[model samples]
Target: MSFKSAFTLTSLFAVTLSVAAPARAQTTFVDRPAELRSGTCASPGEVVTSLANLVITAGDPQGQLGATPVEQSGTVVPFAISDFLAADHAVVVQQSALESTVVVACGEIGGALNPDGTLAVGMRGMSESGLSGVAYFTPIDTFQNTLVTILLVGDGGTTTVAVVDTTVAAGDTAMAGDDTTVVAETGAAPR
Candidate 1:
């Protein structure tokens, strides 16, 4: 081959290899789905109020990832799981009644990621709020976006209740106390 043609071909091959190399490397980590890491928060001391806003941050309370409103029962937070587990993280729940400055509840993110890419952590309430709960981190998508579910319950003689449906067909001869309360009437069978 002519020198000019040979040089041109070599240049093209080098460029092709350079471009493909990064693409291959990118796929190495991309194949693995995002992970989930969670933490729980509670009152540092005695205080009143179960409603608050939840935030995920890099251990520091100021380094926030995202914030979402949380109810007494629970709430869902949308954040990238990989980013959450990248470093030491914390879940902070601030009381809305006190202008959200009071860190009513907080939990440090720890523990190894499960085989299914899920993690759970415990939280403590700030002050004497008598609030505590478990934070469950779950992967909702392949892109690493996690749906953080925070379930909070009072500490003082408060029982966390979950309603389950045990409805059975009439005359099916099922066990006793099989009544079910339909929270919503979607006209669809429970999956």
Candidate 2:
């Protein structure tokens, strides 16, 4: 009730609020740090602006946790085209007990995960201009050794999604889910 008491309380609240804020990172951190060997970029800012601005966890499509972006999967996590940061190519992740990483353009995943064509797997954002970058994804490997699935989003509304059987190994093209053009045959008669 007293002015002094009120001022002290307010100051305490202000101190707490200030402390709650997050601290900035001194340097950039990347899953593929070694791959980031570029003389053109030697600073944190450059690293972020060069490739993979963020990582989305399996479920957390939005970069809630810091600049190290990851795509969280399991629960239909969506990656925004703008978040791709065309200034640099973006790394996509569908992380979980099983983790996978993919590189995509700005508007690659604008809507749902519609691997609609026989070529690619992704969504659309803004106009056709959004998803105009190289599209890549990784199988749920370990922290540093995830495989990249290189494929095109293809014409029409098709996002090429394939299941790569890791057991098949990278060199072998027979691996299922390897982002290949192999189509799965479903039950029922064809016309």
Candidate 3:
């Protein structure tokens, strides 16, 4: 019957639709596990807040993971994420000396998978215009293919010692990425 034929076509169409649709996002290496280097840290509570003067270990236009606002001596100074081999895109920050050097790395992350779309699309894309050029700041507008917005949300967390992962590596090619300009205000004990 025509009704049976119609149903068959519809089922086929549905199957085709699903097959043609784009696949889900696949993480090649979603380096979310932000663990600190045990031996390198000086003290138990001494936090590694930022990544300053980071040396990118890969990429053509090399990138560095600096620009982390860490809580240090009741002040925020640009520091590195880990003792070494950082995640390049994550940061570990301490809230209030939670545990002995108990560092935490968290932030809003999402981004463009393909060109002409979004990029480093975290919770939301930071208006590139918002970060024009005031000082040694992150290149917001010029480069659209980057993490749109990366800010530590939530109230003063329970943990005090944290590390902000810059995702940069050592011995990278392009020395264009630096932390001096990316971080804002830094913070109370971390900046």
| Over 4 Å off, model 3 | 26-39, 48-191
lDDT of 1 by residue, 80-176 (tens): 5566565555666655434456555577766777788887877666656566777776776574445555655556432222222223233432222
What's the TM-score of every candidate structure?
Answer: 0.43, 0.21, 0.24
Over the full model, what C-alpha lDDT does candidate 3 score relative to the true structure?
Answer: 0.27
RMSD of each: 23.3, 20.7, 19.1
Per-residue alpha-carbon lDDT of model 2 for 1-191, expressed as tens digits?
99999999999998887677654321112221111111212111112212222221222114343333222112111222233222333323211112222222232222333352211334232233123223433222232222233222224242222333333433544211211221212232111
Candidate 3 to truth, TM: 0.24
Compare the candidates by TM-score and give the number of the best one. 1
**lDDT per model vs. reference:** 0.44, 0.28, 0.27
Clashes of each: 22, 37, 50
Q: Which candidate do you rate higher for TM-score, 2 or 3?
A: 3
